[model samples]
Target chain A: MDRAIAIDVSHLSKSYGSHVAVADISFQVYAGEIFGLLGPNGAGKSTTLRTLITLLTPSSGTATVLGLDTVRDADKVRHVIGYVPQERAIDRFLTGREHLELLAALYHLPKDEAAKRIGELLKLVELESHADRPAKTYSGGMKRKLDIACGLLPDPKILFLDEPTLGLDVQSRLRIWDYVRMLKARGMTVVMTTNYLDEADQLCDRLAIIDGGRIKTLGSPVELKVGLGGDIVSVTLKESAKIPALESALKGQPAIRAVRATDKGLDIRVESPEKALPAVLEAANRLNCGVEFIQYNRPRLDDVFIAHTGRRIEETTPSKME
Target chain B: MKEYWQEISALTMRWVRRLSREKFSMLFTLVQPMLFWLIFFGNLFQRAADTQVTQAPNYISFLAAGVVVMTVLNNGLAGGVDLLFDKENGFLERLMSTPIHRTSVILSRFIFVMAITSLQVLVILGVAFLFGVRPATGLLGIAAILLIGMMFGVGLTAISMAMAFSVKSHGDFFSVLGFLSLPMIFLSSALVPLAAMPGWMSFLAKFNPMTWAIDAVRPLILSGWSEALPHVGMVIVVMVIFDALCLYGGAKAFRRAMG
Candidate 1:
């Protein structure tokens, strides 16, 4: 897809004294695409997002939003971008509509125009009936919806969501996901950070897998999964001792690329699961090890992370995405 | 520039709306100083608040200016509290991410707290009327009293906002507030004349900005403009310097915190 660059972050690093929250990293987000920073907690997702939105200055390197430098033209950048923080940012004392009105006023929206926008945003978030109720009374999902509505008051060109569905119930999560897709459909570039593997895979157009304050890899979900290594046939042997023997026997067979013995069983990587399944079972039988269980599917994003980091990021976080 | 004012007014009105919703807090804020300090405590010491000692027609008249200044001090010192709560709850981050003028946040708070303090001053002056006391200088005298209170408030509010930016937690902010407010009120001429105090306490009162504010406002209520003029001039100069220093400190802390 040919799209103009909405955000360009080059060699960015943010540190606080001895602790580095975001090490040197660089990536670009194309306009109208949903770009995600996918990582477990404390992986510098928030710091990078903060810098891009001009909330925090980078320690080194530079970033531009719509070709405006983030630090030097922070004010100009703010006018064009919307940010929904990781934490719930609603004022409990203010009603949902009041929150939108306050933001509109901050943005200097004209009274007549602001009124119309507030009404439309309230409806957009499905808070029309509860718009006048104080946010303290809102449920977790409702509060979050109002928060999103407030962010959209400026009708920004790009929206940054730091963990958009974090702590949301399943139904709320789906609703937020739909809202994000709607934003993209309207040609608004969406940038988000998430620790949920499923969220990155399902929601993002492209994702940068971050770990230890650095981007381990960056690509589309499909490209990342395919690049990890194609179809995998997992063979579990009843006798754990014979797993390594079975692994060596399966290596270099037809369609078999590599074999690794895991605690539970043996995972055989292949060009295709259909072709590799026969070789895997045949090898297990020749080793005289009972093939207790076998399963195969297309490689997942987690395997891509495992390929790069030598560890599972899913183990460090929680989610259906995990 | 127009957007700056819009931002400030909207945020200030937010404070007003929040106060309106909290019925209990609204009532207490308006009536607390009047009931506990002005009416009860002022009368409890009526006999001892002599004309010679207080330099006023009566005890209530003397305490009126004192209470007005005291209210300004309390309101201004606690001015940063809402911002601190906003910071704790992550609203400050959301606000900073927007294009609104950053100074609007601090200035709106000063405006709201000073406005509330002026309202409290008016209420105290009206209550003093019930105690058979009137400002010897009249309506202009009431205006001067508010002016001095505001000048004093600008400085105190700046310091509080600075503290809010620097502190690690809300608990810590309140702790510092208590540590600073009580001693300042007692050490100044809020409850009694500095001359009526011990030698050491009176010496510290000489240095308290609250003492300068109260002394200036006292003449407005007790005597005429000629007598009040000098004190007002001294306090204004003091407030200018105090506000400058506090604003500088607040700006520095804000830059560090925001960065």
Candidate 2:
């Protein structure tokens, strides 16, 4: 049996004046699945999430959460959805427990229920020990946990987490990952946007790689990698000048799909690295280019991104792109 | 309807809880208007009663009503500062993304401002009473004073919230607020009677909502219900119209900002 759809967005487009932020993006998130939107800064990931959460209205097209129109039935959609914004939506003056209780009330939970849920959420986030402390005194990770706890107070059917672990330490990020897994086990549908490629690869059951306000690719991590249909072979040559001879020697081989030079090595894409390595070694010997290092590995999400965009995901981001 | 009230009360409690933690700002908001009444205006007009420059028995009693309105004005106008910070810090967006009614957000802000302003007005009245002033209308008059102050406050709070949504930053919000508040205070009957002002200033004061509020409230402190009732009714009418227009504008701006 097919799973129920938790979120459905179709031909959604958002624009600011003449600049389109989300351009005709379409996707569906299934119930009880962790769906990720992987993109660089200014790639419209947050904009799409914001529109679905009803914080923003789309310029054109329609989005629905659990069959409630995001624009027409915005209030109803909000009622059933929890949103953790990219920015820390925390009040420094309030304690962690106070924040949760306030959100519980805002969600219209009963007083007794709110209290019980707050207690459970604090424990779930492992913030029970410091729940009474002012949020201003909490570290970045602690604050993020508080934010996620606040979002979970409504027991929402769908949760939208925008960069849930952005700017966190490794330990804090791992903790958040665990919480997300736990949430999925409890049958909650989660839609998250992240810049961390590995995090998306590991946590998201399926993801859409968005860039330039468009969905470039969409599939499970393994499926996306397999779709690239090539293995990556990196060869470090003793001199950069020898790259030209190596390329010429391997250019006519059918197994060798593509070749590109990097700062330290030549990155070759091929149908089979096992079959392609012998030809590469022979070419290196004939060209008098010493091979300092060589390795073959399966395509990663980064490789999939590079294959689709012709540039690394990191290179397309705001800081690196500039 | 019950759910609306529940959401409003919940959101209002958030503001109240934050306000309670901010001891210094709470103290300042309550005490600043009283200082103006007791120290600045009170001493300056010390001999006005002797000269019959004022209609009341003393300047403190006449100024007491104005002080109450001023307190409401200050609180109402500054009410959006918290909202501006909320918008800046993303808290407002968080609240907006929830299942609560959107109007409840703005309504709760008005409620929180009115509640705090009512307390400040009481403290100002309590201080004026210590200075030998008694409202001729007594307890009923105190109720009228609060009603007038709140009516005026609702209009001002609506305008402030509108500005908070329209402006881009807190600095711009504050500058606009400062530009409006001082002129509004001087142009109204807050500091002195309209009769004492120049002809043009008096004419302008007639059009000022703040003037209408002070006019309505001043009689409650100095005279009885028979004299104060008409102005009180007029102030309420003005406030209703003013709040309707301002709230409509604020809601429009808020919607645009959310978009």
The C-alpha RMSD in Å for every predicted model, in order, reads 2.7, 3.2
Give all TM-scores, in the order shown.
Answer: 0.94, 0.90
Compared with the true structure, all predictions reach lDDT values of 0.88, 0.86
Error (Å) of candidate 2 at residue A107 is 3.2
* DockQ of predictions, in order shown: 0.82, 0.73
How would you encode candidate 1's per-residue C-alpha lDDT over B1-259 as one tens digit per residue? 8889899999899989998888697678655855568898888889876778877777887888888888888888888999998887778888888898878888888888888888888888888888888888899888988999999999899999999999988899999998998899899998889999999999999999999999999988988899999999999999999899999999999999999
Candidate 1 regions with alpha-carbon error over 4 angstroms: A306-322, B48-52
Write candidate 1's Cα lDDT for A1-322 as tens digits.
5779999999999999999989999999999999999887778888899899998899999999999999999999999999887656889899998888888888889999999999999899999999999999999999889878877889999999988888889999999999999999999999999988899999999999998889999999999988877877888878899977887777778789888889979887888877877777777777788978888878888788788777877534443211
- Candidate 2, chain A: TM-score? 0.87
Q: Candidates' interface RMSDs, in order? A: 0.8, 1.2
Q: Candidate 2, fnat value? A: 0.81
- For candidate 2, write residues A32-118 as lDDT tens digits: 999999888878898899999998889999999999999999989988988887656789889999888778778878889889999
Give the per-residue lDDT digits (tens) of candidate 2, residues B1-259: 8778888887888888887788897676567756666667886787754426568887777787777887888888898888888887778888999988888889899999998888888888888888888888998889878887888788788889988988977889889888987888899987778888899998988988889889888888888889989988888888899888877888888888888
Chain B alone, TM-score, model 2: 0.94
* True-vs-predicted CA distance for residue A10, candidate 2, Å: 0.5
**Once model 2 is optimally superposed onto the true structure by TM-score, how far is the C-alpha of residue A103 displaced, in angstroms?**
2.9
